[model samples]
Target: MATSKFLFGLLLLLILVEMNIIEQPWMPGVEAIDCSGKCNYRCSKSGRPKMCIRACNTCCKRCQCVPSGTSGNKDECTCYANMKTHNGRPKCP
Candidate 1:
């Protein structure tokens, strides 16, 4: 019984270590920022705030970062830089 408990504890430790070593897809670069807040911050400067939030939220959810200003700074997040709408329009604000 004691040997079984020891093996279970060892397995649990391995899992914890593995989790610490892996990086999350949503937080590729910068420290994780709340997508909703990022979207709101950028959209505030937009002429079309509602549309900007909608678009920014989509990109932020995927890329986990919002570009600076009202438009065009996609280099910060490669995923956001590459995104496109169904109509081929830029997807991120």
Candidate 2:
């Protein structure tokens, strides 16, 4: 019975991972996300891709994560969401 329960738990954990309900832990240096690629995608719709990419790079370096879409997904990465410019506006696109 105990063995069966353990197996069930392990199976459930695997399913969660596969479904992306659970994600791998973040550890800098151990794993690095493709910031350039992610930022490019995130900034693709911007009028100023160069400026957007530059700001995104800075935010990604600090937060180690980028929001999942081209826009309005800042809630996905709080650090990115919270970043501000000198005038106290959202910095990351």
Candidate 3:
């Protein structure tokens, strides 16, 4: 009986450890996207660098950059970087 109880306790401990590993959560945050096309065009025509800056800021807040030359459309921006969770907190890199 004692041996059976010991085995059961060990099994329970193993199960708890597994649960902790599986229950790890993912965190989300702002991601940056490429606004090169829009930025260049607007900056050229309007003579306003601020427009590009604002668009970049907005893109950074909403999306993440993928690999360059992978963008499907000229209008579709790519992410330059990602803001993600590290150690239960959001970090931008």
Backbone-clash count (model 3): 6
* Residues 20-93 of candidate 2: C-alpha lDDT, one tens digit per residue: 67665554244558999999999999999999999999999888899998999778999999999999999888
Runs in model 2 lying further than 4 Å from the true structure: 1-30
1 or 2, greater by TM-score? 2
Q: TM-score for each prediction? A: 0.61, 0.66, 0.25
Q: What digit string (tens of lDDT, one per residue) describes model 3 on residues 1-93?
A: 999999999888778756664332332343223556534443444345665455444554455432223223423433333333446432221
After superposition, which runs of candidate 1 have C-alpha atoms over 4 Å from their true positions?
1-32
lDDT of 1 by residue, 1-93 (tens): 999999999888778756866554544654656988878988887888998899888888777777776667778778888889999987888
Local error of candidate 2 at residue 11 (angstroms): 47
| Superposition TM-score, candidate 1 onto the true structure | 0.61
Candidate number of the best TM-score? 2
| Candidate 1 backbone collisions, by pair | none
